[model samples]
Target: MDTDADARVAAGVTALSERSTERAGDEFTRAAWLSLADPRSDEELSPFADEDRGWVGEGLRWLVVAAVSYRVAGREARASRRGVEGIAVARDLQTTRSHPAQRACLDEFVADFRVAAGMDDADAAYRTAADAYREAGDAVDDPHRLATSPLFRAAAAPIEQVARGPANGEIAVEWDDLHGSDPSDPGAFLARRATYKRQRFPSLLDRVVDAGRLAAPRGTTEYGNDSFRCPDCDSTDVNWIAGRTLCLRCSAPMARA
Candidate 1:
């Protein structure tokens, strides 16, 4: 990801962390901390056996291929191979520039880095990631800005449904209760607005879930309700989740049904 985009995601993570800490209560935070402490048990990295192995699986396959190819290749093939691999992962995640600018920003970085690597220019690659990220920032549309830009609706398609519900409002309230954001205050309004903006994208959520930045609930079908899976683990059970179901064991997310 580009610096600016990374910064934005970082900012969102910070917000999510704070909110999680505040609203999820000490129990949730402690559990999350414990999970973080034990990366192996960390729910983030835990295998979702029930998940469908469709585009996401394909993307992962490409990622492995790309990474292996990069590692095995001489310096000449490094940049392009890695770049394509990064894009492959993004595509697998179903991220697109049209909807989630933040995601697009990161993908742009992967693309830029590939070019830099090809040119044998490290600084250029980094700068490209940074510039592209900055440019992408202009396209961002969070909940507060959603009404003004329907583009956000499409980008947020995956997560907006979750974020807009009363549940998220509860989450937001929980955030204020702990962090002390005064909803009635104008200055606090901007902070809240930006905070929600930073936190409200499905693509962003996916990245965090992948990166282990957020705590995902275990038995919730919200994770993989769109796909089918083995009654056991999601693996490539059928190469896709046959039903919009979740893992029965851990409630891990999936996309097959």
Candidate 2:
């Protein structure tokens, strides 16, 4: 039977099929963390234990989509949130159980995240160090140092630096409002709240158009849907104001005659 990339990484079976077993476990573990963080299906999780589960599971992905609906057409915040969430999910998955090959993959993946997150979040560094310790064992006890490999130790160095750096007071919630809410079930209260917010911000130019009571000239569709109707006169005769549609008859200034 043909197994997917995830199955190969999680089980370390595919890595061994292609590469050496020495660090196959770590490599597989890394792959699992990275994949789980981005996105996956229930079928994919079947091979993994509880520890391998995604950060918030697949449900949170939907919530993220809902959140993006509130932001502008293409804001950076939305994209950044998605990227960070992926990293967070992967970090959670890395600590999960894995075969020898899978474990090595995970170590490398964890090491990579540690370096990235260290740029901003200090806690990430400490977490990486702890993971390496668990893998390698105590410094005094490990003589041949077979318990954990050098790569594991190398991954921990940068993490330690992060822990010492100045701390930022920013909070890291997946979705502030979506918390304690279910993304799978449409009826969830958070989902309802999100819906309301989406409706409130329907378009960026709603008010200036005056209750959407106006529209642009028939020939002018330069702004596309951004055009608005004059709210006061209830006419299509409106002008763009602060990126909003405003009625020319109501508050719009006439051109110099």
Candidate 3:
């Protein structure tokens, strides 16, 4: 992880994710947080896995890879196998740009960004996460624009689908809720051209922070391995999670001497 990107992203999230550490609470694995943060969790396409042997930063790396690809390779069809190419880009980015703990911070904020979205003030929460990535600049995406551009859509509930619903004026209401909705009002005409806020329920930040904190730890842990050490890269980190009992340092599943 690039230090420049790390510092900028952290600053943006910390400033926007105003919730104190007391509220954020608990250290979670990347997979654990993804289950709640990623809107497309049902697709199970996210690289994060609850029982996987990696850090939350791993997921941020994927998100970055996707963003990079979206900017450079054009949008990827999530349903297709070609999406796998993004994984390589992600690995290269993670190895080149981030350190372990710094990656943890990335993982935490991305998840927290969604966590904050469930709050009454969704804009503030999203701004924090979005700004962080934007500010990352060459370390990641351009600070002036979204890396995914407009082509990127949240995989689950397509925003396009939501926009297809009846326009504000088309839905006749018993009473005018917005002051500008009334035709006789001076601003009514201009209001007609503006987009109206839609209604959607959200989950609270505190309600979802736990799943990640309790998830298996990522990177090097206290548990060390003594056998099948690598000669080429000197890889030896142990991954003891149920789904992945391998070497984190080199992606070697089973070290054979």
Predicted model with the maximum TM-score? 1
Where does candidate 1 have its weakest 10-residue lDDT segment?
50-59
lDDT of 1: 0.31
Off by over 4 Å in 1: 1-65, 68-96, 100-103, 106-119, 141-257
Error of 3 at 204 (Å): 27
State the weakest 10-residue window (summed lDDT) of model 3: 150-159
> How are the candidates ranked when ordered by TM-score, highest leading?
1, 2, 3
The TM-score, computed over Cα atoms with residue i paired to residue i, of candidate 1 is 0.24
Candidate ranking under lDDT, highest first, comes to 1, 2, 3
Clashes of each: 23, 27, 7
State which candidate, 2 or 3, has the greater lDDT. 2
CA lDDT of 215 in candidate 2?
17
TM-score of each: 0.24, 0.23, 0.22
Off by over 4 Å in 2: 1-47, 50-79, 98-119, 122-127, 138-257
Model 3: pairs clashing at backbone N, Cα or C within 3 Å = 1-97, 1-98, 2-97, 27-213, 28-212, 28-213, 30-56
Could you give candidate 1's per-residue lDDT for residues 1-257 as a string of tens digits?
23232232233223332333122222322232232233233233322222221112222222222232222223335435544655544444433234333343334334333432243443343344334434444443332343123222222222322232223211222333211143233223222322333333323333433333232221123323434554435432221121223233322333345
